[model samples]
Target: MIVWSVLIALAGAFCMALGSALQERDAVRAPGHSVARVGFLVHLARRPRWVIGTAGAGAGVALHLVALSGAPLTIIQPIGVTGLLFAIVLSALFNRTRVRAGQIAAGTAVMAGLSGLLLLFPHSAEVPQLSIGTGLGLTGAILALGCAVFAAAHWVRPGPRVLLLATVGGAALGTTSALARVVAANAAADWTAVFTWLTPMCLAAAVLGGLFQQNAYRTGHFAAAYATLLVVDPVVGAGIGALLLGEGLPTTPLNQVLAVGAALLALGGTVVLALARNRNPEALRAVADRDEPTATKPGNASPGARASTTTTSGESR
Candidate 1:
């Protein structure tokens, strides 16, 4: 079951990466002001790449649900970060983009750190109840944050600049996933819970997080955006789950020490990816440059020919 879940999640990562590439292909050409929802559906219908990408996303989600059914959220969330590394690989393969050795190394560090946490930390066997007030409050906070991120995304320069928004989105998703766990365990019906404040927040987080992540991929360094969003979001959610909800840590001093160490490891990994990316501004420039429409594919057309092209790229991210 674990193996199948892992494979499914990894496949989902592949789908997500493909979707980003396809969406980016169009988003770069469209004016920045276009409605993202309309742009996304149109792009999906028009681009075979996007259709495949969307299918990948569906496959991934299906797999993710399977994983959730069997494993604890902490175990599953960290593993989900594998998609970030997967995104880097898929982007290289499909988009003809390059993944620097440093990017790979940093991503590996994050994976290693997250994996260490998973192995050392015991799963919560006790099902948690989702408090209605807590759920509502958390959801409200996430919605406000999402709006802030979208508004803020516009002000920031394209590139790694959008990573913050992606991180926020990721955090929102992570938080909601945690809430979903509690709700699933306690609520009479998950749909009934949806009418409460928590549902909208979770939905918004998933949607906006997806949007923010898509934009981050389109305009930011691949590894940096992927790592920051994937790693940090869940970590923040986990922190909230543990601290606020009183999810117990390992009892032994050594286990406790290791848990803290794992947190640092993840944090260090995030910093490493960020630093490596900042040092390689050229890579970021490549992403941001590709985000806007160009007349021709690299080496395929002259500058004058590109200037005359009428292709309109559009998407929310």
Candidate 2:
């Protein structure tokens, strides 16, 4: 079961990577003011590419549910850290750029560190328990945190804004993972378990996460946004698993120290990726502009206008 879960989760990671790449391709062209708002999702929903990308993401979620049904949350959740690697490659391909060595090394570090930290936790078969009070409290806390981050993103520059949005997205999705584990476990026993409070909470969290994810993509910093998301998702999920699901980590001093080291490695990798610049920013900008309306296309603009737009875009990134 564990082996099968791993394989399924791997496939899910690829789908998620594909989804993120496709979504980011269109998201970067969205009106910047609309991001982090409901109007943003409404606009993307009209675009066929974004719709297809949403489908891919939905498929990935379904596959993740299947994987969660078979394996402990700690073991299964960390598998998603691999999606950062796939996302890096896919983003490069979409942007018509080559993947840099630094990106590869940093992505590897994030995967390794997050994977190590998660795998160090002791797995358990115990069923997850979530009382109504605890569930409500957790849900409220996540929502509050997301709102706070969203508000803060507005005052920051694009790079820091992307990271803040991704952080909230990851936290919400991590909460979703914990809730889904309980839902999956219950559904396995009684299919009617799908009609529960936790199910709605899970869906709400997923939606919140998805919104922030799109906002991050809109910032046009794929590596930083994606690396942050991938790192935070598993870290938050593992915390929820250990605290709420009874999947505790090693109690040994050596193991605890190693886990902290792994976490620091992941943090360092995320910072490196965030600082890494795109190799061909102009090319990427051109490709993204292709999705804009004909009236807004660079070809339609005067030389001075085009130059101004370019400067603005550069500063925003």
Candidate 3:
């Protein structure tokens, strides 16, 4: 049962990753807020592709829910990081995105380290729980901090927006995942856990993280955003679970070494993603060009096929 649950959670994470990838493609050509929303609506309305992506995400979530029911939060969260690897492969195949061998190697290191570290956490029969007051206070603080950082990042030149959104989204996803781990563990707890401040905060973080990544996809390279988010989310979640939740470590020194190694694996993967992004700046544009949009102006062959036109009264237009 525990294994099954883990599989489900992983499936959900995988779906979510794919969805993020698809949304990011759409964001590239969207230009502005209104355009982006309209683009999304149009994409979803007519394209069967988005539906497929959504279905994958839904399946992954369902699996995750079952997995959480059986395993410790600490254990499950690290394993969930596999979705990053899956996303890399899927994006490469479906989106025609470029990836470097170094990125893949680095990501492997990080995941390996994380897996080792997670093994150190003590499994408890007790499920996780959320406290309304604590959750609200913590969530409010994090959101405020993230928003401040986001604004500051936007204030700077353009390139960093990808990094900024990646950072914020990582934090948001980390918080939400950490909270979710707690909630999953506390499934057997009382009803009060359901109404706690963590509930709303988790929901909000999930939404914000989705939006942040969406925006990241629009204005920046996918590898950059995906790599940063992938690397940071599990790391942050594990760190919080260890420090705040009193999760422990492996007793043996060798295991500790393995844990560090796993962390390096995850980091390596992230580097691979980053380098890939740098090497192929136009990767995002390529994906965007392929994804069909919902609404087309009359007499258009496709969004990418439009040729520049001039009226008789040309005025530098």
Candidate 4:
């Protein structure tokens, strides 16, 4: 079962990478704020690439669900880091450009740090349950916090905006994943758990996270945005897992230091990769154009970064 779980999780990882690449391609081409509104979903309904991307993501999620049924979160969660590796490949292929050694080193650093973090988390056989009322309260709090971040994102610069949204989205992803494990674990023992606030909360978080990722993708650095997700999602999950579930943290000094060191290493890689040459230039221009509308406002100014437009294939990412 462990082997099978690992295999299934790997498949999910690949599918996730494929979906994001495809989605990012279309997302970059999309008019600013279009996908954020209700109308663009209706617009997206007819686009084949976007649809395919959605399908790929859905399939990956489905596979993930299956994988979790057999594997512990500790094992399966780290497997998600592989998605970044896959995305790196997809980005190079689509751009018809060879990847730089630096990018590969950066990606390796991220995966290594992620693996170390996962190794530090403690696993337990226990499954914690929240009363429907408690679950609802927690869900509300999470939503309020995430929405606050989302709102704050609009008032900030692009880099901060991306980070805030990614963090919010990652928080949602973590909570949703933790809740899912709880829900699934208790489904047989308590049928009532299947019909509670957890279900709705999980769905809502998943949707919100997906929306955040979509918007983040519009920034044109597929690897950059994804690297953030890879870091934040599991850190959040580990936190929630420790507090809400029976999951444990590094108790030993050595484990704690190692985890922090690994995290810093990953962060260092992400910082270096952000400046990679392969990122689409049109995205910068699009962002600059968006900020233009707010430039004249007292505190709201145009993007500080100068943009260069580089046209790629019909797939703009």
> What's the distance in Å from true for residue 254, model 2?
1.6
Off by over 4 Å in 1: 1-30, 33-48, 64-80, 155-160, 187-197, 250-252, 272-317
Q: Is candidate 1 or candidate 3 better by TM-score?
A: 1
Which run of 10 residues does model 3 get worst, by summed lDDT? 308-317
- In candidate 2, stretches whose alpha carbon ends up further than 4 angstroms from where it belongs are 1-10, 32-34, 61-80, 279-313
- Per-residue CA lDDT of model 1 for 119-202, tens digit only, reads 665556576666668777777787788677666555454443545655775787688678766656656545475466555556
lDDT of 4 by residue, 155-245 (tens): 6644445556666777778777777878988997888878877899888877777777776676666787788787878888788788766
Candidate 1 minimal-lDDT segment of 10 residues: 308-317
TM-score (all chains, Cα) for each model: 0.69, 0.82, 0.67, 0.81
The residue-by-residue lDDT of candidate 2 on 273-306, one tens digit each, is 8777752253245433433221235768898887
lDDT for model 2, please: 0.79
Model 3 C-alpha lDDT per residue in residues 149-253, reported as the tens digit of each score: 655654442245666777677888888988877876665456565565677789888876766666566554566577677667766776667666666455578
- The lDDT, on a scale of 0 to 1, for candidate 3 is 0.60
Which candidate should be chosen as best, given lDDT against the real structure? 2
Candidate 4: lDDT of 185?
84
- RMSD value for candidate 3: 8.1
lDDT on C-alpha atoms for all candidate structures: 0.60, 0.79, 0.60, 0.73
lDDT of 3 at 66: 70
